[model samples]
Target: MTRARTLPAASHLEARLGLEMGQYSCAGRKAINEDAIGIRAPDGPLLTTKGVAAVIADGVSSAEAGREASQSCVTGFLSDYFSTPETWTVRHSVQQILTALNRWLYRSGQGLPDARRGFITTMSALVLKSQQAHLFHIGDSRIYLLRDGRLEQLTRDHTVPVGDGHRYLARALGLDIHLEADYRNLALERGDLFLLTTDGVHDVLGAAQLAELLVNAGDDLAATCRTLCDTALRAGSDDNLSCQLLRVSSLPTPEIDDVVGRLTQLRFPPPLAAGNVLDGFRIERELHASPRSQVYLVRDVQSGERFCMKTPSDNFSDDPAYIERFVLESWIGSRINSPYVARVVDPGRPRTCLYYLSEYVDGMTLAQWMREHPRPAVEEALYLVCQIARGLRALHRRETLHQDLKPDNILIDASGQVKIIDFGSCSVASIAEIATPLVRDSALGTASYAAPEYTVGRKPDPRADLFSLAVITYELLTGTAPFEGKLERCRSQRDFLATRYTPSYRINPRVPHWMDGALRKALRFHPERRHGDVSEFAHELQHPNPAYLEYHQRPLMDRKPLLAWQLIAAALAVAELVTLALLVG
Candidate 1:
C-alpha cells in the first residue's frame, strides 16, 4: 500500500494575500500540495494602467513531477520575464516567456523515471494588460471570468479519453513526451470574477456548486475562495483542490479618438514623368504593382543615386490606419541591412500620399524565378535559405518579426542572391496587439507556403516565418512541397506530417541528408523543438556536411530532355523492327 504525503497548511497560502488579491490552494487528504496557485500585481508601469496577473497549475498526482514543475513554471516566469524592461509588445512578451517555461519544464522532465519522468501539470495564466485579458493555458487547469453572477470557463483542456479516450486532450504540455504549449487571449471587463482552479473543483463539483459560491461570495472574494475549497473537500474530491478568485478591479477604458476618414473620390493621377524633379529626386517609371501601393524607379538628382519609391494604393488614399502602417513599415524597413533584404536607403516624408523609397533591386522575385525554373539545384536552394535566414536574423535582432515570409515576398537578384521584401506585415516589439484580422476568416497568405499556425488564427512570430521558409525551401529543393501538391492534395497541415520527419530520400534521391534533417526540424509542428532563431538555421545551412553534397551530386538518372527523347526514339525503332519481322513471317 502507498503512504500518502502530508498536505501543507492552507494558512501559508491564505496569509500571502488579504482582501486586495484573494487566493487559496489546498492539498486536501494528499501528503503534498502538488496543486499550486500564483497571484501577482503589476510590478511596474502598465501599458494601459490595468494590472497584469495570473493563476497557474493543478498538478496531476498521477504525474509525480507535477507539483514542482508547475510551481517552477509559475515562479520561474514571474522571476525571469515579468515586467520586461524593453518595450516589447504584449503578445511577443507573453509568447516568449511561455515558450521559455515550456522548454525548461520539458528539459527538466527528460530521462526521469517513468513515475517521475516527464512529470507534467495543467497551466492557466491570465495577464490583465491594457484592459484586456491575455490568457495562456495548457492541460486541464481552468480560468473563469465571472460577471453578473455568472462564471465563464475561458480555457480549453488537453486530456486523454476515459470511456473511449474521447475526452482526452489532443494537445497538452509535457504529455506527449514533448514540451510545448498553446494559449488564447481575450478582452476584459470590470466586475469580472476570474477563477483559476484544479480539476478537483471542476471535476467533482457541478456548475450549480461553482455558481452558488461565486454568487454568494459577493465582494468577500477571500471568503469565497475558502468556501470553494471547503465545498470540494465536502464533495469528497479524490484529488487535490485549489482555486484562485480574481476580480477585474479595473478594466482599462481607452479614451475615444478621431476615426480615420474615408478615402476621397479623387484618384492619385500618375506620378511625375522621368527626369521630373521633386524633393531631392527625379521620377523615372513605375517599378511594380500592389493592391494598396505602387513602386517607382527614381534617381536622387543630387547624388545621382537610384531608388524605388513606394506609394499607397490609389484605393486606400484616405484610410489613416493604412497610411500609418505604411509609414511605420518605411521607418522599420530602412534599418534592415542584410544581403537577403531589399535595401531600404531612406524613409522619405509621409505627408504627400505616404511614400518611401528603397534601393532598386535588379532581380526577379523568387516566385517569378520559381515559375521559370521549376526545380533549383541543391546548392542554389541551400544558398537561398541561408540568405533568407540571415535577413530574418537581422529583423529578429531589431526586435521585429517578419510576420509574412514566403517566396513571393523574397526576391532573387541577378547573382543567385535572395532578398526579403514586404514589411507591411512587420510589427514592432512594443505593440502587443496584432492588427491583422483578414486571415482569420479566409486564407491569410499564399496558400502553398503559409505556416500552419498562421493558417489557423495564432499570432505570427519569427518561428512562424521560419515554418514558411522551410516549406518554401522544401518546395525549391524537391520541386514540390511536403504537402498540397497537384497529384496529392494535402487536406490539412497535420496530413503532411504526423511525427517530425526528414524529407524522404525518394523525392530526390539526391537530396543531402543533413539538409533534409535541418528542413525537417524547422518544420516540426511544435515550435519549442525547432531552432530558436534564424541565426541557428543560417549556421546549419552554411556548415552542411560533406555527405549531403556527395549524395545529391551523384547521377540518379539522366534527366536531360534530350536523353528522354532519345529513349523514346529507341523504343519506337524496336517496335518497328518487331512489326516488320511479324509481317514477313
Candidate 2:
C-alpha cells in the first residue's frame, strides 16, 4: 500500500511543513504605515490539506481610503477562499474571491463610513499547495522567483505608460466593479527561495543585490526577510517597507488517492504553432498574447473550418479567477446572436480552458474605416448606419446594453454590414443594482463619446446607447466629431457641443438636405430628443423628411428689439395691402 504525506503527525512536523508567516511594517518616510498584511486559519483543519499562507497589501498614500480598503481586500479574499470547498481549483478560488472583493469594495466606497474610499493600492500574495507556489496580485507589489541563482518578477504591475516612468497603476485592486488579479504557478525546488515585497524594497534594490542577500542570508527564512526590509531602509527608501520570504525543502505533493475529480476537464498545452489542431480545429494564426492568456485563429481540422481560441496567460495556469471570467465571456458570447455582435460558438466552463470560438470576420473597425475612407457617400454611410441601428434593436430586445459602444467596438464588413464586438463591460439590468449610486458616476464607458450624464451619478439607459450612435453618425456625415479638439486643449464641454453640423449639402452639395436634417435629429445631445429606438432611427433614414420633433430643446431664443422690429414691419405690410384693396373697391 502506498502511504500519504499527512499533515505533520508529530507536533513538531505540523509546525514544520505548516509554518505561520507574518509581517513588520515601517513608516520609513511616509506619514503613515498604510501598508498591511493578514492571515487566518479559523480551524486547524482548514490548513490540513494545504497549509494556509500569507497575503500583503501596500496602499497608495496619495489616495484617502487606501489603508482600510487594502487590508479588507486581503482579509476578505483569504476568508472566502478558505471556507470554500477544497475540490475547487485555484483559478475558481481566486475568481470568486475577486468578484466578492470587488462587490464589497465598490459598495463600501459608495456609502458613508467608507474608511478606505478612493484609496488605491498595490497587492501581492502567496498561497502554498503541497510543493507548488501560487501567487496572486495586481498593481505593483511583486512576486520574485529565485531559481538557479536568478531572480524573476512573477507579477506584472498595472501602472500607466511612462518611458517606463508612469506612476499610477493602470489597473488596481478595487478601482471598478470588475476586478482581476494576475497569478503564477511554479514548482518549489529545494534551495529555491520566494520573496514577496512592496515597491519600497524593489524600487531601491537592483536584481543583483536581491540575489546576493538570498544567497548569504543562510537558513533563517525570517532573518532573510528582515535583511531585505533593513536593506531597503538603509538605502534611504522613502515609502512603507514590507517583505515575506519562504524557503522550502522536500515540499509536499498531492497523492492520487487524495485528489477529487471535477466534472470539467481542462488541460493546458504550451503555446501552439500554426497548423496545430485542438478540439478538432486547426490553428491558423496567432491573435493576441498578454501575460494572462493567448488567442489564436483555429479552424475545424475535419471541415477545414476556422475560429478563435483563447488560453490562459503563461503565468496564470493556477489562477481560478481568470478561468472563471474567460468561461463567463465564452458563454455570454455563444448565447448572444446578433450580426452586430461577435457570435460565439463555444462557451467554456470550469472543466475546459477558456477560448472564444467565434465566426471568422473580415472587415475594418469603424475607426479604421473612417480614417481610410474619410468621406464615404451619404447614401452609403446611412445604409451602413441603419444596419447598426437594426442590430442594436435586437440587442435591446434581449435586454442587453453594450456598455462599451465606442468606434473601435464597431466593425464594418465587406458588405458594409456593421458588427458590434467586445461585450467585456456588459452588465445584466436589474432594478436594485442599477440604482447603486457609485456605479452611476464612475465613467464606465469610453470618454469623448460618453454622455454627460455619465460624468454625473446617473444610471445608464437605452438613451446612453443613442448618445453614442449619434456621435458616430455625426462623424460619419461630417469629417469631424462634435468634440474634435485635443482633450487637453478642449477647456469646456460647451466648446465641443454639436450646435451646428456642416450641412452635408454645404460640404458635399450633391448630398440631399432631407438626409442632413434626419441625421441631425439622431445626434441629439439629450437622450429624450434622440430617436427612442434604433428601428425608428433607421426608418427616419429612409424618409429623411419625416416630421420629427427636434432632438434637443433649442436654446431659448434671445429675442431682442431689432428682431421684434423686423417682425412688426412684416405684419404692417400685410395689413397695408388689405386696406389698399378695400379703398380700391
After superposition, the stretches of candidate 2 with alpha carbons farther than 4 Å from their true spots are 1-277, 288-295, 310-326, 347-351, 430-444, 485-514, 545-585
Query: In candidate 2, what residue range of length 10 has the lowest lDDT sum?
Result: 430-439
lDDT of each: 0.66, 0.63
> What lDDT tens digits, residue by residue, belong to model 1 across residues 1-585?
011112111110011111135677778888888877776664323422223466578655666587887788778666554554333555567667767676666666776777344656778877665445678778888887778887777777777677953365554456654545666777656567778888878888877779888877656666777788888889888778888776655433322122222122223435556666656677888777778777788888778878888777768665655655665567678666677788777534433444677778889888788888777677777788888888888887657777777787888889887788888877666533422221122233565666666544556668877877788788878777664442133345565454334464558776767777677777776677677877776666657856555655655444345766888899999999999999999
TM-score of 1: 0.48
Separately for all candidates shown, the number of backbone clashes (residues 3 or more apart, or on different chains) is: 11, 20
Tally clashes: model 2. 20
User: Which parts of model 1 are misplaced by more than 4 Å?
Assistant: 1-87, 90-280, 318-321, 335-339, 347-350, 371-376, 415-417, 433-443, 484-504, 542-585
Q: Candidate 2: TM-score? A: 0.43
Candidate of highest TM-score:
1
How do the residues 41-124 of candidate 2 rate in per-residue lDDT, one tens digit apiece?
A: 333434543345567788777667788877787777777777654434455566677777767766666664554446466777
